[model samples]
Target: MSPRTGVRLVTIFSAVVLAFFLFGDWLARRDAPEPLAWYETYRESLWQPIQDRSLTLLQADQALGRGHLWMISADGEPALVSRYNLESDDRLWQAQAVIGLGAEEMESLVEAQAWEPGIRDQPVSPAVGEALGDRQILRMSMIPVEPLELNRIEGTFGSPDVRMPVSEGEAWVYPRAGAVVAVGEEEAFSIMFGLRDES
Candidate 1:
């Protein structure tokens, strides 16, 4: 091709490339995610266990309502719970034995007792429910209850008459003001655990 023609083609190509880049930037700017306080709260709640415990045991934050966020470890170990109140930017959580125990502790427990997940599986029944402190705890047969997600009385707080089930599960038990639920911009909801129904 002639030198003049070559120069013209190169100039046109460069202009097209520059225009595409500038337009792309503008498009991205328009479609970017908004910076919402909820998002920041979500991200902050996600990193709590990572900061307090090990990231390897990080689990899914299943509960997201009002303004609070909850996450549970897969192994039914202690869960990383967090409550985010946007009104005043308040956050709280419980990181110890939320589900089970640490990996090392769990390993030791299993090695010492020959206990493990599914080593002995039993249907969740009302008797078991009573043991869990919920006298009315009805065992919804085959209701898709994850054995690990089920809540039980930890030896730490349960009665001495009944030995705590050395297994995995979770209890969404909260007192009147334990689980904070923020609604809209100003409303709030709270739950408080009362005396265990022994009936």
Candidate 2:
């Protein structure tokens, strides 16, 4: 190629490269992650004064102290509350002061135990879904119970069925998992996520 043509080609390439990087930096700076950015939005928007009052007044599961339920977290990292606050409907979330269950809840859990059933090819109905969860497989230490008989386990309902002794422990609420089925001698909570207090 001629010297003139090569110089023209090189000049065009350099201009294009320069334009690309310049735009890229502008985009990144505009979208930078800012911690207080979210907080500032909440104050300026619908949540306004309420959010401001909350930041100063509300802390830790209701009472003010070290165990505050809502805070920036230990390592300056975002925590559950911090993340939740970013949502537009954050005001709707009822601020819960309750952490672990009370004495009564503990007492109910005392007689009852969680069972870990083996994973099956499909999820049996909590009643018949034998391969459900730990709450279902292990009979409560206090009560004598038998696991349901079944095989295949299924979808996202990964948590197994749980059983509590007939009429005991504030009714086994498998809050996080799946729906609960009323079996012969057991109260079934679906999966193990919703009301799953167990890890």
Residue range 1-199, candidate 2, lDDT tens digits: 9999999999999999999999999998675533222223432321222222222222221222222222222243221121111122121222212122335533443334221233222211222111111111111011113232111111212334454554532233333332233334333221111132335
- Model 1 RMSD in angstroms: 19.7
Please give the distance, in angstroms, between residue 39's alpha carbon in candidate 1 and its true position after superposition: 4.0
Q: Which parts of model 2 are misplaced by more than 4 Å?
A: 1-5, 17-93, 104-199
Model 1 lDDT per residue over 40-61, tens place: 3534343333333322212322
lDDT of 1 at 136: 18
Backbone collisions counted per model: 14, 33
Best by lDDT: 1
